[model samples]
Target: MSEVQQARPTLLYVDDEDMARKYFARAVGSEYEVLLAASAEEAIATLATDGARIAVLVTDFRMPGRDGGELLREVAQLYPQIVRILVTAYADKDMLLQTVNSGEVFRILEKPLSVAQVREVLRLAGERHRERALRQHRLMAIDETLAFLAHELNTPLAAIANFARGIESRVAGEYTEQRQGEIGQAASAMHDNAQYCLAVLSSFLQSVRNSAGSKAARPEPGAEVSAGALVASLLDTYPFSGDQRQWVQVEMHGDFPVQTLPNCVALVLSSVMSNALRALAGTPSPALRFVVVAQPHLEIHISDNGPGIPPEVMERLLVDPVTTHASAGGSGLGMIFCNRVMQSFGGGIRIASASGAGTTVTLDFPSFKNRMIRSDR
Candidate 1:
């Protein structure tokens, strides 16, 4: 066998008939490392010995002395990741329904199985098995990397925060009123930025830690906050480069009070802003327009004049991590993370874009009354 064939996941096929087992192995042996057993008991023993290497399991449902349904139930409990497919000549609808309802089988194949049918079924099963394994591996890798990055960032962030505070204190005490006005503004900006960084770091670390474990992370319950104030604070504290800060504008329509976790909201807005800045990197005159409209529902729209998202990418942007600029260190997790946070709050995010026109991301928050109703429920 070639190295590629040897690396293929093993597919276990069980049947009582010699011809069926031999036919299956002959048909799928080239695509997968095929394992054959004559009975359910033999299949069970094989699985017990080498189940970890087996990605897909195909078994005849009518095997004597321990049927496929019972064996599948056992496999579901013992090796849940293995994709199970049932092949049977029997027209027992109830047994097939039970097998499917119990979620013990990935697919059902009726017999006198042709080579073409078996090949297609095995192909789908193999694809599913590989996809599940790859997803699990990626998640594990992301969790470990994020945990390490969070730990390394904590100490330096704390030191920088402390230093910013010291600068503010010294400026207040040593400088005259006139000098303090000019120097204190810079010190206060530094202090504000440091505090914002700490807040973002804490929120991100907590989110990663929560996801790494089995339990889902719940957002802190609502707090009454001024929506206008929250947006203004995020805009002021975001680390904008020279001439970039001048290109952004914010407008608040009316008094907007929202009841939600401020830090979560801030993180979402910051991520949107960060993406906008990155997209507008090479534009001649980039501009960001932010508008907050308070009414039946709270709507915050952030529009940027930059190269818009491509059609193919915009379709699955939130569903997966995809970046147009991978060379610039974009993992494409920002929008996905923001979407999850919004879902936790019973809110949602929407993106509208056209190629070369620009992109506008809208954040919709549940109204105050609706938030209260949700909390009460």
Candidate 2:
């Protein structure tokens, strides 16, 4: 294909009527490479094959099998990057409002769809798609930089602390014993400070990667650790502010092994826990609960008693995310990255919240058939 052909963004138009499909394909073929599907099923199949090339999905709402609203919902959940538009002949105000809000659709085009309207909608959608692509590229670049910083600083920092210990040990003698002991304590403090700094850096960097990383490679399943141990490690390592540690209550219903890297799990938990903590801020009698369950499948529930998420904002967390605190440099990538991690591990994450009721985030791990029970060490 020529550069011009490749430059033109692709748009998928779904309609049950044959004439309508042809009309749309003919109408907007000049600006966008139009792909047509007869029904929701055919549209899904086309996306399965050509989704990477497609930027916009425009569908006729009334159809035989699955309606356009249903397809839009599915696409929003699965391929969130693709922009969605609903073209309906009969627009029920309530239904349209609900569908558009829930799906985070780009636009709603009423039937008798004019060529001008279609062109304008596609133009806007194309612009949005391009902007998102650029933003995603930038986020990935930032993540690469963070990774490099972490890699370069970690080893040398550890070596410096180790060398400090040796220096403290070598200066020990009868005259210098007291001085050497004080020096040794200083070395220990240095090590602790360095380690603490590294831990905080890792947590902050990991949080960004969790939200910004669009395409992180899946690592092979690593060694397993007990849920209790994992949770304890997370809570222990997490840097809590004065009196914030007192707010958390950890409970273990049952213990089971989780087959995933501890760091990956910790990062995922950190993102959600960060969100919960932000919500809990300034709330009276703020409470944070971390619970583990080892039943049909291992589950970690992080619940906070705070002002709950709004309906529109909660819906967008997975479908179309935007951080509640943009002024505070929130990227709104938390749930998206978390969901990707869960999917990578053949598991899933569930977020349940209401307006007045607090939010609960549940990380659901897939079950493994080979089960081993280990006595506590």
Candidate 3:
């Protein structure tokens, strides 16, 4: 084996015939650490002792006592991360169909396997194994980073907020009318900005907690929420300046009440609004219309007359992080986060857009009646 292949995990090759097993191992032994087993029973014994170190399993379809199909089923249930491949000399249509339906086998190899063919299959299998490992590693790293940031940033943020409030109070009582007017404006602005920063920080911390597998902070159970009131409050506190605030118009069609985690709902809506604002930047007479319809279920439609999402971006927008404006510090996590939040509440989000036309994001929530019953229980 080459030095690089020696560092990789062992690949097990199983067959009922000793000659077949030796021949198969000889073909691939130079490129991989090959372990040979004469039957399914022996293969199971080898796996029991060294399954964790086995990267791939190749077994013959026909075997005495236990078959390859049964062995693959057992391996799939126990070591699902391990890559499995089946090799057969005979063509049994029904057996092939059964194996495919079980979904345990990654790839099926016909009998008379060539060195080149087995080498290529093993290469693909190794790639899949490495990709799965990388994805899991990244997810763990993200969770750890989020937890550390939430813990480290919470105390300093609180201290800053308190100091800003203290300055505002002192400026109010310790100055004359003229002096107070000058200093109070600055103090008030500091306090307002601090509060906004704290709000955003809190939202992000909650998201971190959720990602770390803890239940998100929510309102009291059975507490009724007014959809219109919530929307109005979010808009009023949203950081909008000058005519930009006036560009957003809200229309309420009917009264909608729901029982859910208010903070989670707010986070989802805030993310949507933030994305809309970013999209509308630098557009002429940029307009945003928020329409709430509340009959069968509550639906919020956020429409913007800005350059719509590009076709390439829209394709993997929700599936993966595809950013259009990375220079502007877009992380491409807004829509993905919103989708997760909606899924937590058994709700969903849909987006529609074209090249020149505007974009529309629709958030759908469960009916109040259904949610109320769930909350009550």
Error (Å) of candidate 3 at residue 243 is 44
List clashing residue pairs in candidate 1.
none
Local lDDT at 177 for model 2:
66
TM-score of each: 0.43, 0.58, 0.44
Q: By TM-score, how accurate is candidate 2?
A: 0.58
What is the lDDT, from 0 to 100, of the residue 76 in candidate 2?
A: 63
lDDT of 1 by residue, 1-377 (tens): 65553486798999999998888888888878999999888988897677778889999988779888878876765565689999989898888777776667999998888888888888898899878678656656655675577678877877876786677678876878989877766665565445445555655455444334332111122223466766677665555656888879988887565445455676687778777877897888899988898766788999999999999999989899997756544677878999898877678899999789999999988774433333222
Candidate models: Cα lDDT each = 0.75, 0.74, 0.73
Off by over 4 Å in 2: 1-6, 174-178, 200-377
Total clashes for model 2: 0
Candidates sorted by TM-score, best first: 2, 3, 1
lDDT of 2: 0.74
Per TM-score, the best of the predicted structures is 2
* Model 2 steric clash pairs: none
lDDT of 2 by residue, 229-277 (tens): 6667666767665577788889988876654444466667777776777
**Candidate 3 lDDT, 211-240, residue by residue in tens:** 344212222223345666667767765656
lDDT of 1 at 113: 89
Worst 10 residues of 2 by lDDT: 368-377
